[model samples]
Target chain A: MKPLPRIVSVLSAALIIAAAIGFLDAAYLAAKYFTGGPIACSVLDGCDTVTKSAYAVPAGIPVAVLGVMFYASVLVLALVFRERRSVTIARLLAIAGAIGFLASVWLVSVQVFILDALCLYCILSAGSSTAIFILGIAVWRLAVARANASDAAGHDSTAGRLPAVGNK
Target chain B: MSKSSIAILGVVVLAAAGLVYLGIAADGGPAAGGQAAIMTAEDHVKGNREAMVVLVEYSDFQCPACAAYYPLVKKIAEDYANDVAIVYRHFPLQQHRQAVAAAQAAEAAANQGRFWEMHDMLFEHQGEWSGNANAAELFAGYAAAIGLDGDQYRRDVEASAGRDRAQEDFQSGRAAGVNATPTFFLNGQRIVGPQSYSEFAALLDEAIAQNR
Candidate 1:
């Protein structure tokens, strides 16, 4: 088997963690909707209010479900494009993740400051997604630099060998 | 090592350390405080296991604010089930017409040994029955749907026993300095409004440690 590139390994791990966070987020919401498991919250009525709120779902789908989809897509992209053509895709994924994560943070802030409650699962998902975005950007940058250096070296070697001309 | 390589390693280590910190902080660790009485009916028999944190929730069934906070409270209950016992008092605002009846319905459900379940149901279906014309009958139907004896539930509701319980909850909430719905007393430290899980976790851990 060919050795995996260092950048691919790092990004893959980050993506997996992001996916796990998404899974947990989905589980928490589903449990509330389906089962009567006491939600884990620290604020008063925090879990119930946030989970049952309209914002809990975007476009009629649970936000947790969307989180899962987003994380899974990132993970899939990281795995499929690993090393080769990975940097560009990874950077794009990171940028998208950052936007999504920021949006979630904004929602959580509203839930706290405006709605006056805290949803533990939502917080968890937001934190994890933020970390994933950070890591994805870092890894992508590293991959790009490596690719650039190699390209530069290929040119240098070709340029170093001047065409031999017979002395006239 | 190259400067860039060092930076990469630093980022990886920092990320790893952060995850570890989060994991350790998942439950109350060194800063774990004593939680207030959050015992379920079953755990009530275990004697007053004085909780280190006391959470006071002022709620009105008809109020959208209270409905919004339902999930947040549930999360706290699950996250710190053994350590925290929340005291749910009622604070029915005047603006909501059916708030009183809904509160009463919840108390009636408590009589049937299903207060929490009915509490969740009330919040979840707040829009469906809170201020509707058929609120009384609709709420009664919910009690039945949740497996409470319909006849007994109806009698208690009509007799105002549920209403009395709700009033008592309201009185207690007022005494606790709650001017709004969903106020929290984390170890007797009062905080108002909604909070994030990370924020809660940090505060809760601090209380736990202090109590310990």
Candidate 2:
């Protein structure tokens, strides 16, 4: 069996870590929102203001819940790609990462320009999602590179192949 | 899905649940708010200090949410006056320009033993001075209206004691893990998600029962 590409493993691992971190951050915020209590801020103190603001809950759902869902999806997709080396899962990871990235941009904008306060936990969440997005782009570039190399050499890239059935 | 995939997902789900549990337990908490839940000689108390249920509120005078909850809190203070002790603390936000000043003014009133009067007055008239440039002056007038001695009120409002008092509460509230205004802790545990008057009373009842 061929060793999986170093790039694939590295990027997948990075995505998984970032997504897990994002999941924790989002989940913590969601819990605090549900409790309707004060938010814990070890670094920055503006989270309570942000969370208590009207913007915290939109159309009845706390924004933190959305974050939890998004990060959870990323974690799952990254896991599938890591295990099966499935190109479909990788592509989906990239897509989810793009979506999360866009969401992060909007959230950061809300904090800096609109809310005028910074929350340490919120910033952690934003950083985690941004990292996943960057790793997704890296995975995408690797795929393109593999495709080009395969075209020149007339040999299929094993790195992009799906894991064989019954091998699990 | 492969067996390993199922296993991985199960772990993620469990971890998520554990995090939530930690939040409720506040395993590392009793933040300054929780630790300081015990009343002090300097605290502004509005009910039976001997009551078993102590409801501490971290609030800002200019915050709309705090103002909105003012009546609900006022009602709670009255309904549970004998069963609950309501403690007011300052938590002025940076966004609201007049919040800190209002808090300081309330503290000045506190020096004259008129904290609650100033607190209620500020909330009732929040609309008048929320964004007004003359908020401090308006607060001084309120102080006078609330029957605080003019000379003492002015001295208290202008002196470092007022600012220090407000800052003290602000820091304590922050230590207690409060970020927003009108954050109420019924018996030192935060009151989460109940917006109506009944909902608050229900929690207080639970606390009262627990005490007995």
Winner by DockQ: 2
DockQ (model 1, Cα): 0.05
Local lDDT at B143 for model 1: 88
Q: Which candidate is the best by lDDT?
A: 2
lDDT of each: 0.60, 0.76
Task: Give the true-contact fraction for every prediction, in order.
Answer: 0.01, 0.26
lDDT of 2 by residue, A50-131 (tens): 7767787888888899999999888888877777766667677778888888988887888766655567788898899889
Q: Candidate 2, which segments miss by more than 4 Å at Cα?
A: A1-5, A29-62, A83-88, A111-121, A157-168, B1-10, B27-68, B75-87, B91-102, B108-159, B167-194, B201-212
Residue A26 of model 1, lDDT score:
52
Clashing pairs in 2: A35-B192, B32-B175, B33-B176
Give candidates' CA RMSD values in order: 15.3, 6.5
| Fnat for candidate 1 (0 to 1) | 0.01
Q: Report how far off residue A147 is in candidate 2 (Å).
A: 1.8
Span of ten consecutive residues with least summed lDDT in model 2 chain B? B27-36
